[model samples]
Target: MARNVNYGALICCLFVTSIFLGIFVLVPVLVALFAYPSSPSFSIDLFDNQALNMTRTDDSPTNLTIHFDLKLKNENKAIGLHYPDPQIITFSYFPNVSLLTILAEYKLDGFYQGNGKTRHVQGMVVATGFPTVLEGTDMIAFWVDLVGSYKYKKDRTKMHRVELGCLVGIDYISSKKMQSGFIGLVEPGLDSKLKKKPSPDYGYP
Candidate 1:
Protein backbone atom coordinates (compact mmCIF):
# COMPACT_ATOMS: atom_id res chain seq x y z
CA MET A 1 0.00 0.00 0.00
CA ALA A 2 2.90 2.39 0.89
CA ARG A 3 4.63 1.61 -2.45
CA ASN A 4 1.47 2.53 -4.40
CA VAL A 5 1.14 5.84 -2.44
CA ASN A 6 4.76 6.73 -3.26
CA TYR A 7 4.19 6.04 -6.95
CA GLY A 8 1.06 8.25 -6.99
CA ALA A 9 2.97 11.18 -5.37
CA LEU A 10 5.73 10.88 -7.97
CA ILE A 11 3.17 11.01 -10.81
CA CYS A 12 1.51 14.09 -9.32
CA CYS A 13 4.85 15.89 -9.04
CA LEU A 14 5.70 15.08 -12.67
CA PHE A 15 2.30 16.38 -13.86
CA VAL A 16 2.70 19.63 -11.93
CA THR A 17 6.19 20.16 -13.37
CA SER A 18 4.89 19.66 -16.88
CA ILE A 19 2.14 22.22 -16.33
CA PHE A 20 4.56 24.84 -15.03
CA LEU A 21 6.99 24.26 -17.92
CA GLY A 22 4.22 24.69 -20.49
CA ILE A 23 3.01 27.90 -18.89
CA PHE A 24 6.46 29.53 -18.52
CA VAL A 25 8.20 28.26 -21.70
CA LEU A 26 5.74 27.07 -24.30
CA VAL A 27 3.37 29.99 -23.94
CA PRO A 28 6.04 32.62 -24.61
CA VAL A 29 7.42 30.69 -27.57
CA LEU A 30 4.01 30.60 -29.20
CA VAL A 31 3.43 34.31 -28.55
CA ALA A 32 6.80 35.26 -30.04
CA LEU A 33 6.29 33.15 -33.14
CA PHE A 34 2.98 34.82 -33.91
CA ALA A 35 3.57 38.37 -32.69
CA TYR A 36 7.02 39.31 -34.03
CA PRO A 37 7.21 41.02 -37.41
CA SER A 38 9.63 40.00 -40.16
CA SER A 39 12.61 42.07 -41.22
CA PRO A 40 12.56 44.17 -44.39
CA SER A 41 14.88 43.69 -47.37
CA PHE A 42 17.36 46.39 -48.47
CA SER A 43 19.51 46.89 -51.61
CA ILE A 44 21.38 49.66 -53.41
CA ASP A 45 21.88 50.38 -57.13
CA LEU A 46 24.62 52.58 -58.53
CA PHE A 47 23.39 54.51 -61.55
CA ASP A 48 26.63 56.01 -62.89
CA ASN A 49 29.71 54.21 -61.67
CA GLN A 50 31.82 56.35 -63.98
CA ALA A 51 31.18 59.34 -61.74
CA LEU A 52 33.41 57.68 -59.16
CA ASN A 53 36.78 59.22 -59.98
CA MET A 54 39.54 61.25 -58.48
CA THR A 55 40.49 64.83 -59.36
CA ARG A 56 44.11 65.80 -59.76
CA THR A 57 45.59 68.72 -57.69
CA ASP A 58 46.01 69.56 -54.06
CA ASP A 59 44.45 73.05 -54.05
CA SER A 60 41.24 72.06 -55.84
CA PRO A 61 39.17 69.54 -53.91
CA THR A 62 37.59 66.59 -55.75
CA ASN A 63 33.84 66.59 -56.12
CA LEU A 64 32.59 63.02 -56.52
CA THR A 65 28.86 62.68 -57.23
CA ILE A 66 27.30 59.25 -56.75
CA HIS A 67 23.81 58.72 -58.12
CA PHE A 68 22.07 55.70 -56.71
CA ASP A 69 18.72 54.09 -55.94
CA LEU A 70 17.94 52.60 -52.59
CA LYS A 71 15.41 49.77 -52.64
CA LEU A 72 13.56 48.83 -49.46
CA LYS A 73 10.99 46.07 -49.26
CA ASN A 74 8.61 45.09 -46.52
CA GLU A 75 8.41 41.32 -46.38
CA ASN A 76 5.77 41.01 -43.71
CA LYS A 77 2.52 39.53 -44.87
CA ALA A 78 0.03 41.58 -42.91
CA ILE A 79 1.98 44.27 -41.10
CA GLY A 80 2.72 47.62 -42.77
CA LEU A 81 5.85 49.72 -42.19
CA HIS A 82 6.24 53.36 -41.17
CA TYR A 83 9.67 54.84 -41.83
CA PRO A 84 10.73 58.02 -40.10
CA ASP A 85 11.74 61.13 -42.00
CA PRO A 86 15.30 61.80 -43.12
CA GLN A 87 16.92 58.42 -43.31
CA ILE A 88 20.71 58.51 -43.19
CA ILE A 89 22.69 56.99 -46.05
CA THR A 90 26.47 57.07 -45.85
CA PHE A 91 29.09 56.17 -48.47
CA SER A 92 32.55 55.28 -47.27
CA TYR A 93 35.80 54.03 -48.75
CA PHE A 94 38.52 51.84 -47.31
CA PRO A 95 41.69 53.80 -48.06
CA ASN A 96 43.75 51.17 -46.31
CA VAL A 97 43.20 47.83 -44.58
CA SER A 98 41.76 49.17 -41.35
CA LEU A 99 40.65 52.75 -42.00
CA LEU A 100 37.25 53.75 -43.44
CA THR A 101 36.70 57.22 -44.94
CA ILE A 102 33.31 58.79 -45.55
CA LEU A 103 33.08 60.11 -49.09
CA ALA A 104 29.46 61.26 -49.19
CA GLU A 105 26.21 61.31 -47.24
CA TYR A 106 22.61 61.89 -48.22
CA LYS A 107 19.37 62.31 -46.31
CA LEU A 108 16.68 60.13 -47.86
CA ASP A 109 13.07 61.05 -47.28
CA GLY A 110 10.94 58.43 -45.59
CA PHE A 111 7.56 57.06 -46.57
CA TYR A 112 5.07 54.33 -45.79
CA GLN A 113 5.25 50.87 -47.34
CA GLY A 114 2.54 48.27 -47.53
CA ASN A 115 3.15 44.65 -46.89
CA GLY A 116 5.28 42.90 -49.52
CA LYS A 117 5.89 46.21 -51.24
CA THR A 118 9.19 47.61 -52.55
CA ARG A 119 10.24 51.26 -52.74
CA HIS A 120 12.84 52.78 -55.04
CA VAL A 121 14.34 55.95 -53.53
CA GLN A 122 16.41 57.90 -56.05
CA GLY A 123 19.00 60.28 -54.62
CA MET A 124 22.56 61.50 -55.03
CA VAL A 125 25.40 62.45 -52.71
CA VAL A 126 28.28 64.73 -53.67
CA ALA A 127 31.58 64.15 -51.91
CA THR A 128 33.64 67.31 -51.61
CA GLY A 129 37.19 67.49 -50.34
CA PHE A 130 37.73 63.85 -51.23
CA PRO A 131 41.20 62.75 -50.13
CA THR A 132 41.57 59.30 -51.61
CA VAL A 133 43.95 58.69 -54.51
CA LEU A 134 42.76 56.02 -56.93
CA GLU A 135 45.64 56.35 -59.38
CA GLY A 136 47.44 53.07 -58.60
CA THR A 137 44.49 50.75 -57.92
CA ASP A 138 42.53 48.95 -60.61
CA MET A 139 39.49 48.58 -58.40
CA ILE A 140 38.24 50.48 -55.38
CA ALA A 141 35.78 49.30 -52.73
CA PHE A 142 33.09 51.40 -51.09
CA TRP A 143 30.90 50.69 -48.07
CA VAL A 144 27.31 51.87 -47.71
CA ASP A 145 25.56 52.18 -44.37
CA LEU A 146 21.85 52.89 -43.97
CA VAL A 147 20.27 53.75 -40.65
CA GLY A 148 16.55 54.24 -40.11
CA SER A 149 13.73 53.82 -37.63
CA TYR A 150 10.46 52.08 -38.35
CA LYS A 151 7.23 50.91 -36.75
CA TYR A 152 4.78 48.20 -37.61
CA LYS A 153 1.16 48.86 -38.35
CA LYS A 154 -0.06 46.62 -35.62
CA ASP A 155 2.38 47.86 -32.99
CA ARG A 156 2.47 51.62 -33.15
CA THR A 157 3.41 51.96 -29.50
CA LYS A 158 6.94 50.63 -29.98
CA MET A 159 9.44 51.85 -32.58
CA HIS A 160 12.16 49.67 -34.03
CA ARG A 161 15.38 50.90 -35.57
CA VAL A 162 17.64 49.02 -37.93
CA GLU A 163 20.91 49.42 -39.82
CA LEU A 164 21.70 47.79 -43.13
CA GLY A 165 25.17 47.83 -44.69
CA CYS A 166 26.88 46.58 -47.87
CA LEU A 167 30.18 46.82 -49.74
CA VAL A 168 30.75 47.22 -53.50
CA GLY A 169 33.92 47.35 -55.57
CA ILE A 170 34.08 49.49 -58.66
CA ASP A 171 36.42 48.63 -61.52
CA TYR A 172 38.03 51.56 -63.18
CA ILE A 173 39.02 51.41 -66.85
CA SER A 174 40.93 54.65 -66.36
CA SER A 175 41.84 57.04 -63.60
CA LYS A 176 39.04 59.41 -64.57
CA LYS A 177 36.25 56.98 -65.44
CA MET A 178 34.69 53.78 -64.12
CA GLN A 179 33.16 50.99 -66.15
CA SER A 180 29.82 52.19 -67.47
CA GLY A 181 26.66 50.33 -66.48
CA PHE A 182 24.36 49.79 -63.55
CA ILE A 183 26.15 48.11 -60.68
CA GLY A 184 24.32 45.08 -59.37
CA LEU A 185 22.62 45.56 -56.02
CA VAL A 186 24.09 43.68 -53.11
CA GLU A 187 21.89 42.47 -50.26
CA PRO A 188 22.96 44.14 -47.02
CA GLY A 189 23.49 42.50 -43.66
CA LEU A 190 21.06 43.49 -40.91
CA ASP A 191 22.64 44.65 -37.67
CA SER A 192 22.24 42.04 -34.94
CA LYS A 193 22.39 44.64 -32.19
CA LEU A 194 19.18 46.21 -33.41
CA LYS A 195 17.04 44.39 -30.88
CA LYS A 196 19.13 45.37 -27.89
CA LYS A 197 19.18 49.11 -28.53
CA PRO A 198 16.51 51.46 -27.22
CA SER A 199 14.09 52.97 -29.69
CA PRO A 200 14.22 56.67 -30.49
CA ASP A 201 11.50 59.16 -29.50
CA TYR A 202 9.54 59.62 -32.70
CA GLY A 203 6.36 61.08 -31.06
CA TYR A 204 4.35 58.16 -32.31
CA PRO A 205 1.77 56.33 -30.27
Candidate 2:
Protein backbone atom coordinates (compact mmCIF):
# COMPACT_ATOMS: atom_id res chain seq x y z
CA MET A 1 0.00 0.00 0.00
CA ALA A 2 1.29 3.53 -0.84
CA ARG A 3 1.56 6.01 2.04
CA ASN A 4 -0.84 8.99 1.80
CA VAL A 5 0.86 12.28 0.75
CA ASN A 6 -0.40 15.32 2.69
CA TYR A 7 -0.84 17.82 -0.11
CA GLY A 8 -2.97 20.11 2.10
CA ALA A 9 -0.19 20.40 4.72
CA LEU A 10 2.47 21.09 2.10
CA ILE A 11 0.41 23.89 0.54
CA CYS A 12 -0.23 25.48 3.93
CA CYS A 13 3.49 25.42 4.77
CA LEU A 14 4.34 27.14 1.49
CA PHE A 15 1.79 29.86 2.07
CA VAL A 16 3.12 30.57 5.57
CA THR A 17 6.73 30.76 4.34
CA SER A 18 5.81 33.20 1.60
CA ILE A 19 4.02 35.46 4.07
CA PHE A 20 7.07 35.58 6.34
CA LEU A 21 9.40 36.41 3.46
CA GLY A 22 7.13 39.14 2.19
CA ILE A 23 6.88 40.78 5.60
CA PHE A 24 10.60 40.52 6.44
CA VAL A 25 12.42 41.04 3.15
CA LEU A 26 10.35 42.29 0.20
CA VAL A 27 8.44 45.03 2.05
CA PRO A 28 11.54 46.90 3.13
CA VAL A 29 12.97 46.91 -0.39
CA LEU A 30 9.75 48.29 -1.80
CA VAL A 31 9.59 51.03 0.79
CA ALA A 32 13.20 52.00 0.07
CA LEU A 33 12.44 52.27 -3.61
CA PHE A 34 9.52 54.63 -3.10
CA ALA A 35 10.78 56.63 -0.13
CA TYR A 36 14.32 57.14 -1.36
CA PRO A 37 16.55 59.86 0.05
CA SER A 38 17.18 63.13 -1.76
CA SER A 39 20.59 64.40 -2.77
CA PRO A 40 22.30 66.76 -0.31
CA SER A 41 21.52 70.43 -0.99
CA PHE A 42 24.17 73.07 -0.38
CA SER A 43 24.06 76.85 0.25
CA ILE A 44 27.35 78.43 1.15
CA ASP A 45 28.72 81.86 1.99
CA LEU A 46 32.47 82.49 1.87
CA PHE A 47 33.95 84.14 4.90
CA ASP A 48 34.98 87.83 4.39
CA ASN A 49 33.80 87.99 0.80
CA GLN A 50 31.00 90.07 -0.61
CA ALA A 51 29.97 87.42 -3.11
CA LEU A 52 31.51 84.18 -4.43
CA ASN A 53 34.71 86.08 -5.08
CA MET A 54 38.22 84.61 -5.29
CA THR A 55 40.98 86.92 -4.21
CA ARG A 56 44.70 86.93 -3.36
CA THR A 57 46.61 89.75 -1.77
CA ASP A 58 49.94 91.08 -3.04
CA ASP A 59 52.01 89.13 -0.52
CA SER A 60 49.87 86.22 0.64
CA PRO A 61 49.64 82.92 -1.23
CA THR A 62 46.22 82.41 -2.77
CA ASN A 63 43.82 81.29 -0.04
CA LEU A 64 41.30 78.86 -1.48
CA THR A 65 38.20 78.06 0.58
CA ILE A 66 35.39 75.49 0.26
CA HIS A 67 33.65 76.19 3.55
CA PHE A 68 29.94 76.65 3.31
CA ASP A 69 26.70 75.40 4.78
CA LEU A 70 25.87 71.85 3.59
CA LYS A 71 22.40 70.46 4.14
CA LEU A 72 20.82 66.99 3.76
CA LYS A 73 17.11 66.28 3.94
CA ASN A 74 15.68 62.83 4.45
CA GLU A 75 12.63 62.41 2.25
CA ASN A 76 11.83 59.02 3.73
CA LYS A 77 9.89 59.25 6.93
CA ALA A 78 11.29 55.89 7.99
CA ILE A 79 14.90 56.30 6.89
CA GLY A 80 17.73 57.66 9.07
CA LEU A 81 21.36 58.28 8.14
CA HIS A 82 24.56 57.01 9.71
CA TYR A 83 27.76 58.87 8.68
CA PRO A 84 30.82 56.91 9.71
CA ASP A 85 34.44 58.05 9.72
CA PRO A 86 36.79 58.45 6.70
CA GLN A 87 34.44 60.71 4.75
CA ILE A 88 36.18 62.03 1.64
CA ILE A 89 35.85 65.72 0.79
CA THR A 90 38.13 67.51 -1.63
CA PHE A 91 38.59 71.00 -3.05
CA SER A 92 40.88 71.13 -6.04
CA TYR A 93 42.20 73.76 -8.43
CA PHE A 94 41.94 73.52 -12.21
CA PRO A 95 44.36 75.37 -14.43
CA ASN A 96 43.31 77.54 -17.34
CA VAL A 97 44.88 75.17 -19.87
CA SER A 98 43.16 72.05 -18.50
CA LEU A 99 40.29 72.07 -16.08
CA LEU A 100 40.07 68.31 -15.76
CA THR A 101 43.18 67.51 -13.72
CA ILE A 102 43.55 69.45 -10.50
CA LEU A 103 45.83 70.29 -7.61
CA ALA A 104 43.97 69.62 -4.36
CA GLU A 105 43.43 72.88 -2.51
CA TYR A 106 41.35 72.05 0.55
CA LYS A 107 39.56 69.37 2.57
CA LEU A 108 35.79 68.92 2.67
CA ASP A 109 33.87 67.96 5.80
CA GLY A 110 30.92 65.56 6.05
CA PHE A 111 28.04 64.97 8.45
CA TYR A 112 24.87 62.96 9.18
CA GLN A 113 21.15 63.54 8.74
CA GLY A 114 18.12 62.39 10.70
CA ASN A 115 14.71 61.31 9.54
CA GLY A 116 12.57 64.16 8.23
CA LYS A 117 15.15 66.64 9.42
CA THR A 118 17.66 68.85 7.60
CA ARG A 119 21.22 68.37 8.78
CA HIS A 120 23.40 71.50 8.72
CA VAL A 121 27.17 71.08 8.33
CA GLN A 122 29.79 73.82 8.23
CA GLY A 123 33.56 74.03 7.76
CA MET A 124 36.25 76.07 5.97
CA VAL A 125 38.62 74.51 3.42
CA VAL A 126 41.55 76.92 3.35
CA ALA A 127 44.37 76.33 0.84
CA THR A 128 47.39 78.57 0.87
CA GLY A 129 49.55 78.22 -2.23
CA PHE A 130 51.17 80.55 -4.72
CA PRO A 131 49.05 80.89 -7.82
CA THR A 132 50.59 80.85 -11.29
CA VAL A 133 49.97 83.94 -13.38
CA LEU A 134 48.77 83.68 -16.93
CA GLU A 135 51.22 84.34 -19.72
CA GLY A 136 51.57 87.96 -20.87
CA THR A 137 49.42 89.09 -17.96
CA ASP A 138 49.80 89.90 -14.28
CA MET A 139 46.45 88.16 -13.46
CA ILE A 140 45.65 84.49 -12.78
CA ALA A 141 42.52 82.53 -13.66
CA PHE A 142 41.70 79.09 -12.29
CA TRP A 143 38.70 77.06 -11.18
CA VAL A 144 37.88 75.56 -7.82
CA ASP A 145 35.60 72.61 -7.28
CA LEU A 146 34.24 70.66 -4.33
CA VAL A 147 33.26 67.02 -4.27
CA GLY A 148 31.89 64.86 -1.44
CA SER A 149 30.84 61.24 -1.19
CA TYR A 150 29.09 59.80 1.83
CA LYS A 151 27.74 56.45 3.03
CA TYR A 152 24.58 56.20 5.05
CA LYS A 153 22.12 53.64 6.41
CA LYS A 154 18.50 53.43 5.46
CA ASP A 155 16.24 53.69 8.49
CA ARG A 156 19.16 52.17 10.37
CA THR A 157 18.24 49.01 8.47
CA LYS A 158 20.65 48.93 5.52
CA MET A 159 23.36 50.99 3.85
CA HIS A 160 22.98 53.43 0.96
CA ARG A 161 25.20 56.04 -0.75
CA VAL A 162 24.95 59.59 -2.11
CA GLU A 163 27.21 62.31 -3.48
CA LEU A 164 27.54 66.10 -3.66
CA GLY A 165 29.49 68.33 -6.06
CA CYS A 166 30.01 72.07 -6.63
CA LEU A 167 32.16 74.41 -8.68
CA VAL A 168 33.90 77.68 -7.77
CA GLY A 169 35.61 80.08 -10.14
CA ILE A 170 38.25 82.71 -9.73
CA ASP A 171 37.41 85.59 -12.04
CA TYR A 172 40.59 87.52 -11.38
CA ILE A 173 43.25 87.61 -8.65
CA SER A 174 43.64 91.34 -8.29
CA SER A 175 42.81 93.61 -5.40
CA LYS A 176 42.47 96.42 -7.93
CA LYS A 177 38.84 97.39 -8.27
CA MET A 178 37.39 98.02 -11.69
CA GLN A 179 35.74 101.30 -12.50
CA SER A 180 32.51 99.42 -11.80
CA GLY A 181 34.00 98.54 -8.37
CA PHE A 182 34.10 94.78 -8.94
CA ILE A 183 36.98 92.74 -7.48
CA GLY A 184 38.94 92.20 -10.68
CA LEU A 185 41.33 93.89 -13.09
CA VAL A 186 38.56 95.15 -15.35
CA GLU A 187 40.00 98.38 -16.72
CA PRO A 188 37.95 100.67 -18.91
CA GLY A 189 38.27 100.32 -22.73
CA LEU A 190 40.56 97.25 -22.25
CA ASP A 191 37.73 94.81 -21.50
CA SER A 192 38.15 92.78 -24.68
CA LYS A 193 41.79 91.89 -24.05
CA LEU A 194 41.38 91.26 -20.29
CA LYS A 195 38.39 88.98 -20.76
CA LYS A 196 39.36 85.31 -20.62
CA LYS A 197 37.70 82.56 -22.61
CA PRO A 198 34.24 81.70 -21.40
CA SER A 199 33.82 78.68 -19.14
CA PRO A 200 30.74 77.04 -17.74
CA ASP A 201 29.92 78.06 -14.20
CA TYR A 202 27.51 75.85 -12.21
CA GLY A 203 26.03 78.71 -10.21
CA TYR A 204 28.10 77.69 -7.17
CA PRO A 205 26.72 80.36 -4.86
Candidate 3:
Protein backbone atom coordinates (compact mmCIF):
# COMPACT_ATOMS: atom_id res chain seq x y z
CA MET A 1 0.00 0.00 0.00
CA ALA A 2 1.35 3.37 -0.99
CA ARG A 3 1.20 6.39 1.32
CA ASN A 4 -1.25 9.15 0.39
CA VAL A 5 0.33 12.58 -0.34
CA ASN A 6 -2.18 15.27 0.53
CA TYR A 7 -1.57 17.92 -2.18
CA GLY A 8 -4.35 20.17 -0.92
CA ALA A 9 -2.93 20.18 2.63
CA LEU A 10 0.60 20.90 1.38
CA ILE A 11 -0.61 23.81 -0.76
CA CYS A 12 -2.58 25.27 2.10
CA CYS A 13 0.40 25.03 4.41
CA LEU A 14 2.73 26.77 1.93
CA PHE A 15 0.20 29.51 1.28
CA VAL A 16 -0.25 30.13 5.01
CA THR A 17 3.53 30.35 5.53
CA SER A 18 3.94 32.87 2.76
CA ILE A 19 1.17 35.05 4.12
CA PHE A 20 2.72 34.95 7.59
CA LEU A 21 6.13 36.04 6.28
CA GLY A 22 4.63 38.84 4.24
CA ILE A 23 2.68 40.20 7.19
CA PHE A 24 5.57 39.90 9.63
CA VAL A 25 8.66 40.71 7.57
CA LEU A 26 8.11 42.00 4.05
CA VAL A 27 5.14 44.22 4.83
CA PRO A 28 6.84 45.93 7.77
CA VAL A 29 9.90 46.87 5.74
CA LEU A 30 7.73 48.55 3.14
CA VAL A 31 5.70 50.41 5.73
CA ALA A 32 8.82 51.60 7.50
CA LEU A 33 10.31 53.11 4.39
CA PHE A 34 7.02 54.58 3.29
CA ALA A 35 6.12 56.11 6.62
CA TYR A 36 9.71 57.26 7.41
CA PRO A 37 10.30 60.11 9.87
CA SER A 38 9.82 63.85 9.65
CA SER A 39 9.98 67.07 11.58
CA PRO A 40 6.95 69.25 11.05
CA SER A 41 8.13 72.24 13.11
CA PHE A 42 11.63 72.96 14.37
CA SER A 43 11.54 75.67 17.03
CA ILE A 44 14.53 77.26 18.68
CA ASP A 45 14.71 79.78 21.52
CA LEU A 46 16.73 82.31 19.59
CA PHE A 47 14.85 83.60 16.59
CA ASP A 48 11.86 85.71 15.68
CA ASN A 49 11.24 84.62 12.14
CA GLN A 50 14.69 85.32 10.67
CA ALA A 51 15.80 87.96 13.13
CA LEU A 52 17.70 87.09 16.29
CA ASN A 53 15.41 87.62 19.22
CA MET A 54 16.64 89.54 22.27
CA THR A 55 15.36 87.10 24.82
CA ARG A 56 18.83 85.79 25.65
CA THR A 57 20.94 88.59 24.22
CA ASP A 58 21.17 90.50 27.45
CA ASP A 59 24.97 90.54 27.20
CA SER A 60 24.81 92.86 24.19
CA PRO A 61 27.03 90.58 22.15
CA THR A 62 26.55 89.28 18.66
CA ASN A 63 26.90 85.63 19.63
CA LEU A 64 24.29 83.97 21.77
CA THR A 65 23.24 80.57 23.10
CA ILE A 66 20.27 79.09 21.30
CA HIS A 67 18.10 76.43 22.90
CA PHE A 68 16.89 74.23 20.09
CA ASP A 69 13.62 72.34 20.40
CA LEU A 70 12.87 70.08 17.45
CA LYS A 71 9.94 67.72 17.18
CA LEU A 72 10.67 64.29 15.63
CA LYS A 73 7.53 62.55 14.51
CA ASN A 74 7.50 58.90 13.42
CA GLU A 75 4.92 58.45 10.71
CA ASN A 76 4.84 54.66 10.86
CA LYS A 77 2.22 52.95 12.95
CA ALA A 78 4.36 49.90 13.72
CA ILE A 79 7.99 50.97 13.92
CA GLY A 80 9.93 52.82 16.62
CA LEU A 81 13.05 54.96 16.42
CA HIS A 82 16.10 53.78 18.36
CA TYR A 83 18.31 56.80 18.89
CA PRO A 84 21.80 56.21 20.22
CA ASP A 85 23.79 58.29 22.63
CA PRO A 86 25.35 61.64 21.72
CA GLN A 87 24.09 61.97 18.15
CA ILE A 88 25.90 64.54 16.09
CA ILE A 89 24.29 67.89 15.20
CA THR A 90 26.38 70.07 12.94
CA PHE A 91 25.90 73.80 12.33
CA SER A 92 27.17 75.64 9.30
CA TYR A 93 26.90 79.37 8.75
CA PHE A 94 27.17 81.48 5.62
CA PRO A 95 28.29 84.98 6.54
CA ASN A 96 28.63 86.12 2.97
CA VAL A 97 25.77 85.64 0.52
CA SER A 98 27.40 82.69 -1.22
CA LEU A 99 30.38 81.91 0.95
CA LEU A 100 29.31 79.10 3.23
CA THR A 101 31.48 78.70 6.33
CA ILE A 102 31.64 76.06 8.99
CA LEU A 103 30.75 77.26 12.42
CA ALA A 104 29.98 75.59 15.79
CA GLU A 105 28.55 72.15 16.61
CA TYR A 106 26.91 70.18 19.42
CA LYS A 107 25.48 66.76 20.16
CA LEU A 108 22.58 65.29 22.10
CA ASP A 109 21.57 61.83 23.26
CA GLY A 110 18.85 59.95 21.44
CA PHE A 111 15.32 59.03 22.48
CA TYR A 112 12.91 56.35 21.36
CA GLN A 113 9.84 57.59 19.52
CA GLY A 114 6.96 55.18 19.35
CA ASN A 115 4.86 54.67 16.27
CA GLY A 116 2.64 57.63 15.40
CA LYS A 117 4.13 59.56 18.29
CA THR A 118 6.10 62.78 18.45
CA ARG A 119 9.25 63.24 20.52
CA HIS A 120 11.30 66.34 21.24
CA VAL A 121 15.08 66.53 20.90
CA GLN A 122 16.66 69.55 22.54
CA GLY A 123 20.18 70.95 22.40
CA MET A 124 22.11 74.18 22.78
CA VAL A 125 23.86 75.50 19.65
CA VAL A 126 26.20 78.39 20.32
CA ALA A 127 26.47 81.13 17.71
CA THR A 128 30.10 82.05 18.05
CA GLY A 129 33.38 82.38 16.15
CA PHE A 130 32.04 84.95 13.76
CA PRO A 131 34.55 87.16 11.96
CA THR A 132 34.85 90.63 13.38
CA VAL A 133 35.16 92.29 10.00
CA LEU A 134 31.84 92.41 8.13
CA GLU A 135 32.98 94.61 5.20
CA GLY A 136 30.70 97.43 6.44
CA THR A 137 27.67 95.62 5.14
CA ASP A 138 24.41 96.58 6.86
CA MET A 139 21.52 94.20 7.18
CA ILE A 140 23.74 91.37 6.08
CA ALA A 141 21.97 88.17 5.26
CA PHE A 142 23.13 84.90 6.82
CA TRP A 143 22.17 81.34 6.02
CA VAL A 144 22.45 78.62 8.63
CA ASP A 145 22.02 74.92 8.02
CA LEU A 146 21.81 72.11 10.53
CA VAL A 147 22.54 68.47 9.84
CA GLY A 148 21.29 65.96 12.39
CA SER A 149 21.99 62.25 12.18
CA TYR A 150 21.17 59.17 14.21
CA LYS A 151 20.13 55.57 13.91
CA TYR A 152 16.46 54.71 13.59
CA LYS A 153 14.86 51.30 13.30
CA LYS A 154 12.08 51.12 10.79
CA ASP A 155 12.93 47.55 9.90
CA ARG A 156 15.43 44.95 11.06
CA THR A 157 18.36 47.30 10.40
CA LYS A 158 18.54 51.04 11.18
CA MET A 159 18.20 54.10 8.97
CA HIS A 160 20.08 57.40 8.78
CA ARG A 161 17.86 60.34 7.82
CA VAL A 162 14.18 61.08 7.99
CA GLU A 163 14.11 63.91 5.47
CA LEU A 164 16.41 66.15 3.50
CA GLY A 165 17.78 68.59 6.11
CA CYS A 166 16.98 71.32 8.62
CA LEU A 167 17.66 74.89 7.53
CA VAL A 168 17.32 78.37 9.06
CA GLY A 169 17.48 81.76 7.33
CA ILE A 170 18.68 84.89 9.05
CA ASP A 171 18.55 88.49 7.80
CA TYR A 172 19.52 91.05 10.41
CA ILE A 173 21.20 94.40 10.84
CA SER A 174 24.94 93.70 11.21
CA SER A 175 26.21 96.66 13.13
CA LYS A 176 29.95 97.28 13.17
CA LYS A 177 29.68 98.39 16.73
CA MET A 178 28.10 95.11 17.72
CA GLN A 179 30.75 93.03 15.96
CA SER A 180 33.49 95.20 17.43
CA GLY A 181 32.16 94.68 20.93
CA PHE A 182 32.19 90.90 20.55
CA ILE A 183 35.68 90.73 19.10
CA GLY A 184 37.33 89.20 22.18
CA LEU A 185 34.27 87.64 23.78
CA VAL A 186 34.85 84.11 22.48
CA GLU A 187 38.24 82.74 23.42
CA PRO A 188 40.33 80.31 21.43
CA GLY A 189 38.76 77.25 23.06
CA LEU A 190 35.21 78.08 22.05
CA ASP A 191 34.97 75.21 19.62
CA SER A 192 36.30 72.74 22.12
CA LYS A 193 33.79 73.86 24.69
CA LEU A 194 30.94 73.38 22.31
CA LYS A 195 32.13 69.89 21.48
CA LYS A 196 33.02 68.81 25.02
CA LYS A 197 29.80 69.73 26.73
CA PRO A 198 28.10 66.98 28.74
CA SER A 199 25.88 64.70 26.71
CA PRO A 200 22.19 65.26 27.20
CA ASP A 201 20.02 62.31 28.24
CA TYR A 202 17.17 62.88 25.79
CA GLY A 203 14.82 60.40 27.37
CA TYR A 204 11.09 60.71 27.37
CA PRO A 205 9.76 63.44 29.62
Q: Candidate 2: where is the Cα deviation over 4 Å? A: 1-57, 100-112, 130-158, 173-205
Residues 72-177, model 2: lDDT tens digits = 4555555555555334434433344433323333443445666667664466655544345445454444332234444445444544343334434344655331
Best by lDDT: 1
Q: Residue 17's C-alpha lDDT in candidate 1?
A: 99
After TM-score superposition, the amount by which residue 97's alpha carbon in candidate 2 deviates from its true location, in angstroms, is 5.4
* Reference-based lDDT, residue 146, model 3: 33
Model 3 misplaced regions, further than 4 Å: 1-59, 130-155, 161-164, 174-205
> On residues 33-152, what C-alpha lDDT tens digit does candidate 1 reach at each position?
448768777777764443444435566545667778877888886678888666787777655545566666778777889977988878787764354533456656566777778888
Best by TM-score: 1
lDDT of 3 by residue, 148-202 (tens): 4445464456556422233343334432122211011111222232222221332
Candidate 3: global Cα-lDDT? 0.46
Ten residues in a row with the worst lDDT in model 3? 180-189
Cand. 3 TM to true fold: 0.47
- Order the numbered candidates by lDDT, best leading: 1, 3, 2
Q: For candidate 1, give the lDDT of residue 157.
A: 51
Each prediction's TM-score against the native? 0.61, 0.46, 0.47
